[model samples]
Target: MHGHQIRRAAQVDRTELWSDVKPGSLYGALHRMQVEGVIEAVRTEQEGNRPARTIYALTSAGAAELIDHRDEALRDTKLRHDPVDLALQNVIDLGEDALRAIIVARRKALAEQLDAWLALRELAAPHIRGLEWTTFRHTELRLRTELAWHDELLDQLPKLMANQPTSMTTS
Candidate 1:
């Protein structure tokens, strides 16, 4: 597919699968893949006044690499690092107000995201099935877990803020 088509597919239905891909960097990624021989430019086509576009096709090596990547992602269970953990550890220094503000903001954002996913699930329930449905379910579960964790943090905020460090030392 052409770069624009690929980007459109990534965006369709708010799939939440391409969180790491920046739209502007896609063409660059395609270029890099072409250089690496993972994908090749099949042809260029232009019609009327539209600019020429290059269509790319994946090679056998690319198919193998893609499968490897998909398998690794599916099998890998280790949790990725979240900066919020580091911030929470040192949150005592920020005072209670800042911590509350940050947590509140995060909760709001998470709630908004959850709402969007829930809406999508509702809308797509009749048409989606199998692996696609499973992906949606997985994302919904993660978001719910995050929301619960944030609520727990809020419940413990008073205790956490009250027990601030009394001294600091470096060795």
Candidate 2:
């Protein structure tokens, strides 16, 4: 697909939900893959009033790489960078007021995410088939689980901070 087409598909699939797949990163990846001879330009075509763009197709190497990456993606239990965890490590410095502010903002973001996933699931359930539907359902379930966990965290935050030194008490 062309640049705009790729971005459109990513938006439709909500790729940013599970990743940091920005347009800049996506385009950069395409260029890097092309440089590595994994993918090559196929043909350039303009659809009616649209500008001509380079179309790309995977090379044999690209297909093989894709298969290998797909396997790792399915089987690997990878740890992702969670900014919240990093912040918690410095919870001592965050003072109660600031920490509460952070938690509130995070809770709001998580709620928004949960709602987005729920809406996506509703959209996908009607059109997606078989295994794809099952995968989408699994994703929806994960989102619900995380959302619930955030509620628990919010409930326990006050107690967690109680033991930690408060800025007012320190100075």
Candidate 3:
């Protein structure tokens, strides 16, 4: 439909899946797609009191490209650039209490993320129906998976701490 609709769809389905699905990236991609003859602007019109909206549709090339990219996306697993992974690799830079604090903070943040997604799912379920409900379901599942992984790390931290040198130990 329009850019807002496109953004709404991406926010639900692709937001957490892709790091670049934010508003800036969405609009930028639309512009690039138009430039590359993948999509065309049909018209812009004001609806009610809102600002004007431009409706875009896929060109023939766009349609073909969409099918190819969608298939490739489904087949490929993209690597994530997670800050937690970076921290895990260099945690020796921190002292014992610092590492413990970091772990605790990370765990809390992950719990909050799970709670937020679950709350969003609850808020969205009544108004959204059919296949749309799966959006919330999928996001909740992803958040839960991440939370579980975080908790697993927390559980292992004590053992990890025990193996570290005295410099890494906290009283």
Q: Compared to the true structure, candidate 2 yields what TM-score?
A: 0.78
Can you write out model 2's per-residue Cα lDDT over 98-129, one digit (the tens) per residue?
87787778778877877886777787777777
> Order of all candidates by lDDT, from best down to worst?
1, 2, 3
lDDT of 1: 0.85
Query: Could you tell which candidate, 1 or 3, scores higher by lDDT?
Result: 1
**Candidate 1 C-alpha lDDT tens digits along 35-102:** 99999999998879999999999999999998998798889989889998976776545878888899
- Worst ten-residue run, lDDT, model 2? 162-171
Residues 75-104, candidate 3: write the lDDT tens digits.
998876888777676666666678878777
Q: Which runs in model 2 stand beyond 4 Å of their true positions?
A: 17-21, 24-26, 47-49, 165-171
Off by over 4 Å in 3: 2-5, 12-16, 19-21, 46-53, 77-83, 127-135, 165-171
Give the whole-model CA lDDT for all candidates, comma-separated.
Answer: 0.85, 0.79, 0.78
Model 1: lDDT of residue 111:
95
